[model samples]
Each structure stands twice: as structure tokens, then as C-alpha cells.
Target chain A: MNRSAFPPLNLRWLMPLLLALPLLVQAADPLPSWNDGPSKKAIESFVSAVTSEGSKDFVQPAERIAVFDNDGTLWSEQPMYFQVLFAFAEVKRLAPQHPEWKEQQPFKAVLEGDQKTLAASGMDGIIKIVGATHTGLSNEAFIDNAEAWLAKAVHPKSQKPFTEMVYQPMLELLAYLRANGFKTYIVSGGDVTFMRAFAEEVYGIPPEQVIGTTFVTQFQNQDGKLSILRTPKLAHNDDGPGKPESIDSIIGRRPIFAFGNSDGDLQMLQWTAAGSGKRFTGLVHHTDAKREWAYDRESKVGKLDKALDQAKAEGWTVVDMAAEWRQVFPFATATSGQ
Target chain B: MNRSAFPPLNLRWLMPLLLALPLLVQAADPLPSWNDGPSKKAIESFVSAVTSEGSKDFVQPAERIAVFDNDGTLWSEQPMYFQVLFAFAEVKRLAPQHPEWKEQQPFKAVLEGDQKTLAASGMDGIIKIVGATHTGLSNEAFIDNAEAWLAKAVHPKSQKPFTEMVYQPMLELLAYLRANGFKTYIVSGGDVTFMRAFAEEVYGIPPEQVIGTTFVTQFQNQDGKLSILRTPKLAHNDDGPGKPESIDSIIGRRPIFAFGNSDGDLQMLQWTAAGSGKRFTGLVHHTDAKREWAYDRESKVGKLDKALDQAKAEGWTVVDMAAEWRQVFPFATATSGQ
Candidate 1:
């Protein structure tokens, strides 16, 4: 076969197209669930600036740390925080073991479905409930309990599994940042172990990257086997000022990007903003009562008054859930909410 | 240009050789600094079993966690723990600002270079010294101070920077483990921030992978700037049992591989060994007196007595440094030690 007989392939024309394949793919909406609004634009602009090779705002891959609050930001936190619901459920689950709980104010209220009495018991009651349900078991056992609870529990309004209630827009954003070489972390106010049960599978954030409230553990060796036993002692609160404290203690670096929706996350956003480089901080405003719950300033769970004000004052992106979210939950169909 | 003219390339014969290329390359010694001995063999076998596909002991990449004690396992801790040495040096450097250090017992002893008095003062004195030099500053300031000290501090015996004192064989082991899909972490009794300053540069372990003793930090906002201020308060004492507790709290998973050289690391090794899989626990026995200091049962710092006996009883890998290490420090040459 002579070389001249074969038609020269016009492959030169395909070179530029092939070279721009990645860019073309990226040109497609990275966050499809995010409506074309300030929230989406702010995210894309921040990510692009940080990822562009020669841009002044470009950050090294290792330093591109982005932290998001688990409750109210990544997932809905209304009808009370999910972790509190888990704790309340635990009181009822363990009520059979503790008959005295039927007489105990908090436990009795939980078992009787009396939210009024439980609310009246206050923070002390909440602490008591957490102590009974979260401690005095091995780490493995506690994780097992949390995993079991999450698998079966559903939101009262949506009737979807707790993990299924994660915001679709936030999930897409998490994936988008990760694809651009950013390490996404959940810096929440929930218990570390509790968030860890569903985080890796649902959000793709690993156990080591999930920083939150922590409890003291003990190294216990029985005969030849060893176990880490959880005790009823608070190690770190991981809320409000505690968020920044844990960030510094555990992550050892100030994150350049932060997302939250409550006053508890104000310090974290402030800390992110106070960094020396171009920083981004955003708050997810609960403004959609039709698709999701919409209580902010007056809501006991995930109150957003201070942080919402700060986001407006600082010109931080405040996501209007009603207008900025094309879809809320992943399970919501176009006919249902989109 | 012609299929038949290529003589079929004899490609069938080359297939076997091509297929075996990876194995041939892997056959090269991954841990070149380790002598052909039981410690090296044990490590190779453990890594092989856990990393080999379809093996009953094979662990998922996400679960392949390895923890190492920093003080004596990765680097030499003779004269005194390097962090303590840094504390003493800090007392001297900050003596001008801390004029009262001249009158305080521990600070005075550190300032005067009075070893006998310092030794007599015991753990209380050490804690006082650590609190004074390590806390009451912002996290960034504390880290800056630590980094500056590490930049200039040298091991008294080797006359090399403290970071240079990291063991060559241990460094090779860390790399080998990482290459085979293991996440390596440093779990030590040293202050987390102090270890973090040089760990990433010297040991290739990042700050997030380091779990150690911690001080309480408070989030402070001055005007519009935010900072994590280090409080003079003990958060967690990461030694012995504290090691396992910190590992559980921070990593949220039990490590499968652990290494240490002192009683402080015993609990960590036990915790790793207790994980339900093919696990590895190692102890670096300080048996070489010429290349490095040698002390076990009677040592004041990094005492290996209890752990040494436990390793023998439990059949954990005990590295006889003088016999097993082909080279000790990276700076050590053939003329110096080989």
C-alpha cells in the first residue's frame, strides 16, 4: 500500500477541540441545582479565581480549604435540628432499658411525645439526653447506633430519610469545588461521630475532614482486645467561637472559603474573611417555606439573624433558598418543587 | 506501513515480559534504608497482605490508616524531648519580655540552664514551662515562634537541626506505606502545633494528620480582625491512653498500623492492633549507642521499658536500630555510620 494512496486525515482541525474538551465540559453548569442568581455567580467566580493558574487570587491546591456547616447549610435544619431529633429518638429507644425514664421529665416527655415538657426542660435537659444516649458505649457501638437511626429516620414533613434531605445545590457545589482541587470539609455544630456516620456516604467528605463537637474517649483494653470507650464528657463544643477554635486546633489552617447559616457560624465566617488573601463566605438563607421550612431569626433551630446580617453587611453571598435554588432535596421531582 | 511487512513484531513473546514489568519494578527495595531483617520482613509482609487485591486481609484504601509516634519513633528524642528543649530555649529568648521568669521556679531554672534544679522540679515544672512559652499568644504567633525555634535548634549530640534528626529508615517506611495506599499520621506526646511546624516538610505528614497534646484555644475578634488565641489551659494530654483518645476523637477511625518507642505509645499500638484486620504495631528499640543515644528502661525521656516488654509479649515488631537500620539520619554518610 502506497502512503500517497491513503487520504491524509484532517486531524489538525480536531486538535483545538480536543485540547478544549475539559474547558467545554466545565462550561456546562457545574451546579445545575443552583438557579442563575448571585449565589451561583459568587460561587463560580470565587472558584474560578482560586483555580485559574496565573490569577492573582489563585491558591495552591493544598491551601484551597473550604468548610461548610452541615446543618442549615448543607442540609435542612428545621422541625428542630436532626441531631436533637436523633437524641430524642434515642431516649425512646433506650426507654425500654431504663424504666425510670418514664418518670424522668425529659425522657418521659420524649416517650410521651410531649414537646412542650421537653422544651421546658431546656439546655440542661438536652445535655442530660445527650449524655444518656451518646456516652457509656464503645465508639463502634455509638457509631452503629447513629448509623441505624439515620437509615430509618425520616423528616416529619418530607417523609424522606434524614440524609436524603441534603440540599442538591450544596452537593453540586461540594463536587464542583472538589473537582477544582479544593478539599471540602464539614465544620458543623453536630457531634463529630454522629455526622461521620452519614457524611462519607452522603456528602463524600471523609471522617477525618468532618470537624464538629467532640466528646472525651478512653483507651480501654480488656484482656488482649482494645476499644475506645466514649465517656459522658464534652471535649469541644464546636459552635460559635468554638468553630474557629476547632478549625485552628484540628485543621491548623484558616480556611479561605466558609459557608454557614446560623449565628453559631459567624466566627468561622469572620475567621475566613480575616485571612490575608481573597476569601469567600456565604450564608444559606431559609426563605422557602413551600419547598422547605422557612424560619430564620425567630427559629430556635439554626437561627440565622446574626449571620444573615453579617452576610449583608460584609457583602457575603446570602443564598435566598426560594429564589436561588432550582431544586432543594435530591429526591424532589420537577413536578413536586422544581 | 504494511501489516505483513512488520513480521508480526514477535509481540506474543514480549507480552509476558511486559506484564511482569510492574512486579519487577516493585521488587526493588522500597525501604532502602532498612537492613534485610525481621523488622523489614514483617513490614513488607504486612503491607503485602493488606494491600494485595482479593486477599482476605486486604483493607480498602479509605481504611488503610497508619499512625506513628513522632518523638522517638520518627526522630531522636535524646537529651530531652525536642519540644521541651524548645520550651527551655523559648524561656531564654522571651526572658526580656517575661521578666518574672527570672524569679519563677521552672522559668528561672530554664533561664539559668540549671539542669539539676529543672530535673528536681519534675512534671509540674515542665507543665509550667510549657504553659508560659506555649500559650497566651495567637495561634499564628505561637506557630511562628515554634517555626523560628525549629529553624535554628539543633540536636546537642548530632549537631544537626532537630528536623534532620528524623530516622532515614522510618522516613522510608512512611513513604513505602503511603505508596501502598496508606494514610500516614503522627500521633505523639509533642504539642500539635510544634510538631506541625516541621512535620509536613520533614516527615511528609500534614498538619491535619497530626494528633498530639493540645492547649485550649479561644476565638477572638479585635475590631474586624479575627484570631484564634491560645489560652494557657490544658485541653488534652496525648500520652499513653490519651493517644488512643485523641486518635479516636480526631481521626474518628481506628488505625490499622501504629509505631512508637515508649510507654506513651503503648495504648496507640494496642488500639491499632485491636482493629479487625491484618494489623501492624512496631516499636523502635534504641539499641545503637554510637550512631544515636541508647537508653530503654532507665531513660527519663522516651522511656521504652513497659512498651519493650509488651512488644516482646505481644510479638509486635521491635526494630533494633543498630542492627536493622542501614543508615540512621538522612545526613549520616557511609564514612559516618554505614
Candidate 2:
């Protein structure tokens, strides 16, 4: 039977042929926003090598753990970190509750809109602001306040909701890794509970997979009902060296892949690199002043100095946001689902 | 065109038919060791109600979280908690290295095997013992010691490895819940790291899903390599009210089902019960003295006083181990993985 003897098939045959044709074709690019560069190529190569069965780098599905640093890596952390801004707003919100806050240095600076004095106050001022707003409420109440704020809070420059400011390329990378049997986790310097509110919806990461700084919480039994109350004291810092420490304590596994932006994530990248296996480490270089903020070593928040230097020396992929990504935030496309 | 004529077919049809027939049959009973009682009935009914789509109690798969206490619930905790035993053994193991331990109060009691004096020392003494054995080493070192001890250590009464002391009915229940879309987590008063070593192999729950008491750890850079050294300091004590606090902090979602045995678990049960929609709470009564050690109100360890009262008053399923379980430990069955 010569195949050339047959003409084009009927509508029924054409329908089934059309339906099955795509399966035989090459799949669509998972990270479309990512420019065709060495950074994207490295990610693709790493994922393929690890996931292909019978290969030397084949990792079991359970062991395919990937951790990401939240602030500068997944979303923008510029002109000051978003959480610091939230803290300042919180100081204003709670100003009426404590009359003495009007006279307080950090509180007064925040209330007076004096960024210079607040910056001079340093981490001590930030901690005080965070503790004042984040603690002294039931866990549910704190979560409610955070959720309400996130619903309305917008980026100062972008004029987009804070959630919408997440990197589209990174979002695509998360989905791609997950599709290849990786469990993505957010190991952040931000509050664990605060990150949890939007992590699931924004990054497709569940709450249990998010590890971050924590405040001391007290269990309360009021009128025979149990509730957890967030306290003023800090529990775990989850920054710098605390990143790897929290990873070991909570995750109980060395992640094969780690992505970060700043020096705070340097230890996490080092830990991942130290693991005896096929590992991938990436640093997001915020070099996009036109599309996004671009302060590095001199920046107060998310300073990416040591990590950027180390990434080059260690052969870790350094994602130049301006050059490597076609788009920065997800709000560029209507179908991005920010 | 007659379907009846095609039934009297070839061996090819018969072979595929034989293979597919088992798929149509009803599934085997997942909880075969559980006796027919109100406790068993309640569990089955609750799981079925919540899992059935379009039902009033239907729950999403992501929300089907179940938490369980370790000691006295999953395994035996009589004669003293297994961890306390491990601490005592560790004290003896490290006695030669620290000759000063001979003169210390808790250390001397632990080294001398003086149960009476150790009991008098209370939680303070236990904490000291735990700190000495569990901390000061790297995370890997601590896990290795715990794993080594668990491998050789036998229950005094049962003369079996402590891992073999897990309740068979509860194991079946875990499998049942998981089969019905529930994710089981061990939220225990025991050490989190200690549980992770065996939880995956024995209980089928992964380390990431386990939440328990934590010890302070410091990040160390030894010869340019990073390591997290467990400190000789107590961190969060996940007991009684701390159970709920840890759950809120770590899991970040209220469990729909909670299983526990003692007063340490009361708050966890209360927290689970307090959640809206379908919820289940279970308590193992420790009523089987013949098969397993039994104790309740006045017992120093595995005390089940207030929780038992609450279980009765709040319609929580109280599992009478003696009457409700056909077998206690999984060792009885030849097919059991243990």
C-alpha cells in the first residue's frame, strides 16, 4: 500500500490527527520571559540532567528540593525593602495606641517621614518598628492585618500591587522546576508568617515550604478557647548565616538548587554548593535601573556585593536582570496572572 | 453487531479481562487491625464525610492536614519517655570525656542510674541531660548518635527495638488518612530531629512534615566549610500549649484532624477542634496494660487527665486501646514492614 495513493483524510480523521499532533511536537518553552542566555541555558541544563532517569545526576523526586531567597530574588527589593516600608506604615497605624511613640526616635522619624534619620537608626530601628507592628496581637489578627495590607499595598514607583511586582521570569522558573518534580521553598529574611500570606498564590509555594525569620509566640487560653499570640521578642533571625541554619533545622535536607540575590543568601548558596551532588546556584544581579532599581554594594537593603563576586568565582549563574530578562514584573502581560 | 457473540473470545481478550477485573473489586480494608467500636466508626465516618465530593463536610485536598503526637500516641512512652532514656545512655557514653559530670547533680544521677534522684530533679534535670547529649555537636553528629541509639536500644518490658513498638492500628489509620487525601504530620513534644531519622522509614511521614521541640543552633565556619552546631541551650519546648503555637508557627494552617495521648496534646486537639467545618480529634487512652503499659491521671509521663475529660465532654473520639485494637504493635503481623 503506497502512502502517496491516499489523499487528505476525512473530517473525523483530521480531528483526531490534529489533537494528537502537538504531543509529538516539541513542548513550548517553560520560561518564555527568560532571554536566551547562559543563565537560562544553565537552568535548563541543570534541571534536565537531574531529572533524566538512568543519568549520573538523576535525583529522586523526594530529593529534588530547591530553595529560593524571597525579597530581591523573587520580587523587587528596592528604594528600601518592601517589608521595611510595611513596618513604617505599621508604625503610623499603631501610633495612636502608644502615645510615647510620638516622642520615640524611630517612631518619630517614621511618623515625620524622615527616611534619613530612620536609615541612620539602623537595624535596631527596623526591629523596633517590626516588633511594634507585627507582635502584640493574636496570630489570626496579625495574619488578618497583613492580608488586608497586601490586598491594597502598591509599589511606590511601579504603581502596581506588591504581589504583581514578582519577577515573571522567576515565576516561570518556579513553575518549570515544579513541573520537573522539584519542591520549591522560600527561605527568606522576612517574617515567615508575613511571606506565607501571599506565597501560595504568588509563587505556588505552600506555607509549610516557607522558612523565614520568626517572632516568639505565646499560646493563650482565653475563655476556654486556644489561640497563639505573637510576642515582641524575636525568635529566629533567618538572615546571613541564619539562612543555612534555618534550612538545616526546618527543611532537614540540603537543597540541590538555591537562588538568591544579596549577601544574606551567601551562606545558603555556599551550603547548597557544598553538598556532594549535582547542584545549581544562582544569584539575581539587580542591574536594571531602567526597568527596576539597580543599587548593589552601597544599597542599605539587599546589597548584592559578596554574592555577586562569589558567583563569578564559583561558576554560579549570575542573572543580569536588565540583560537576561525580557520583562521584570508580571504586570507586563495580561495573562501573567499576577 | 451482537455484543453477546463477541464475549466468547480468544485468550488475548481473557488475559486482559483477568488483569482488569481486580481494578473493579472493592479495595482491601485499610484499617484491618482496628476493632469495630465507636472510636473506629468515628474515624471512618469523619474521613469519608470530608473526602466525599459535594458533601457538606467536603474538604479540599490541600486543607486535609492531620497532626499526631509521637510519645504515647504513635509509640509507647511508658517506664519513661524514650528520649529521656537516650539522654541517660548519652550521659554514660560521654562520662569519660567529661570527668566533671561525676560531680554534677543531674549528670551524676544519670551516670549512677538513680531514677529516684533524676525524678526529683524534674524538667530542669531532664533539660540539662538533653542539652548535654543533643547539643554541642554538629547537626549530622547529633542525628548519627540518635540513630545509632535507636537501632540498638530495646524497650525494657517488650525487649524489642523502640521503633517496633509503634501501634499497628494507628499505622493503619495513618495509611487510611493518607489514602483519603490527608497529609499526616508528627507534631510531637519529642525532639524534631530525633523523630525525622526514623519517621520516614517507619511512619511514612517525611522530615519536612514533622514539627517538634527545637534546640538552639549556631552557624559555624570550620576551616572554610559551613556547619550548624547544635547549642547547649533550649529553644522552643513543644509541649502542652506549645503544641498549638508550634503548629501555627510552622505548619501555618490549623489541622483538620489531630491525634494525641496525654495532656501535652490537649492544646493541639483543642486547636484542631476550634477550626471551622469538619474536624476530628482522637486520644489513645492507654487502657491496655497487658499488651502495652497503661497509666493515666497520676502518672508522671504520658499523663492523660484533663485531655481525657475534655475528650469525653467535647465528643472527641477516645480510643480504648485494649478494646478497640485487635493488635497494638505492628510486630504481631508477619506482613507488617517492621
Interface RMSD of each: 7.3, 7.5
Question: Whole-model lDDT for model 2 versus the true structure?
Answer: 0.88
Model 2 TM-score relative to the real fold: 0.91
TM-score of chain B of each: 0.93, 0.91
Candidate 2 residue lDDT tens string, A1-338: 45456444333434445555656533788888988888999999999999999999999999999999999999988777788788887788888888898888899999999989988999898888888899998888887888888998888988888898899999999999998999999999999998988999999999888999998999888898777999998899999999988888888889999999999999999999999889999999988777787878888789988988888898999988888888888777422111
Off by over 4 Å in 2: A1-26, A96-100, A333-338, B1-27, B333-338
Candidate RMSDs in order: 5.4, 6.6
Worst 10 residues of 1 chain A by lDDT: A6-15
Over B28-146, each residue of candidate 2 has an lDDT whose tens digit, in order, gives: 67788888889889998998899889999999999999999999999989888998898889899889999999999999988887888989999999888888888888998888998
Q: Rate the local accuracy (lDDT) of all candidates.
A: 0.89, 0.88
- Model 1 regions lying over 4 Å from their true place: A1-20, A334-338, B1-24, B334-338
